[model samples]
Target chain A: LAKTTQPISMDSYEGQEVNITCSHNNIATNDYITWYQQFPSQGPRFIIQGYKTKVTNEVASLFIPADRKSSTLSLPRVSLSDTAVYYCLVGETSSGGSYIPTFGRGTSLIVHP
Target chain B: DTAVSQTPKYLVTQMGNDKSIKCEQNLGHDTMYWYKQDSKKFLKIMFSYNNKELIINETVPNRFSPKSPDKAHLNLHINSLELGDSAVYFCASSPPTSGNTIYFGEGSWLTVV
Candidate 1:
């Protein structure tokens, strides 16, 4: 399992774009990066994921560089409801997977309306 | 309807007691996981079960036992709970492959008094 590091906290105003970057200096060859969002008293929700380049969905966009050493999660037009802690995970999801994912201290994004 | 659901969203119990948290996923996924979020908001993987078989078990205490009766249900039974067991327990499920989205439940807040 690859270790990930991210900002402890971030602040953004409503309608603004927020980007949280995660650094995994020792990412494995088969490792895929995933991002999750969690509101207070709720479970984490999948935001976006990418191996390399850019992957966009209806919720967020993930950008990965050629080296795959880091990834960015971009949330567009943020609202107060988007204020939550976001986690960055790197691992392989499989039926016979061995190593478990280590979720370090996540980035808390405070979106003020 | 919620795809991943856990019973007893909030559990307040005394130390040395035993309790169980039940999780059910309607998403038809083959892999399920239990994660614990500490007071500092660091999420850690406790266990992962796929097709009723244990695939990943982290360095969690033996007091924390995971039982999966079938593909859709996974229950966590904690024996002799201690104050350190107080945290948010989240149940999640994913497909058998990586890069796919993992759905999470609302979470069960366990308060050990």
Candidate 2:
């Protein structure tokens, strides 16, 4: 499995754009970078994912470079509710032929008023 | 309808006891997973099941057993629960079409006292 590195924490104000970057230098060929948002006392929710380039959804956007070694999740117009831990995961196949999701330490984003 | 749902959203059990967290997904996904989030806020993959078969079993202890009775249900049973077992356990599922995208349940907060 590919290991990802990201900021431990980030602080932003409401209505601002927040970008969280993740680095996975040893990403495999079939690896796909995905991001998830987790709120306090709740489960993590899927925010966005992309193989390469950019993929946008109503909640967030994902940008991956050509190398696929790194990816970024961009959340526009941040609000206090956006304050949560954001996880960056690189998916890979396991020996049992199932996709294993190993979540590492994520970036905790704190949106201020 | 909830894409992924977990029962007993909060569980407060005594140590040396056994408990189970039940999960169900209506998304018709073929894969399900169980993850543990400790107080430090690190989410770790405990197990994964594909089509009712155990696939990815992480370094978790044998006390943590994941059972998949069908394609849409994955239940986690923890035996002789210790204080370390007190954390948030999340259940997730992903469709066959995407290996990286997953939907998560509200989570089961287990407090071992």
Which structure among the candidates has the greatest lDDT?
A: 1
- Name the runs in model 1 displaced over 4 angstroms: A92-99
Cα lDDT tens digits for candidate 2, A12-46: 99999999999988887876788988888888888
List chain A TM-scores, every candidate, in order: 0.90, 0.92
Model 2 residue runs over 4 Å out of place are B97-100
Q: Mind listing the fnat for each candidate?
A: 0.79, 0.68
Interface RMSD (Cα, Å) for model 2:
1.8
Best by DockQ: 1
Error of 2 at A55 (Å): 2.1
The TM-score between candidate 2 and the true structure equals 0.94
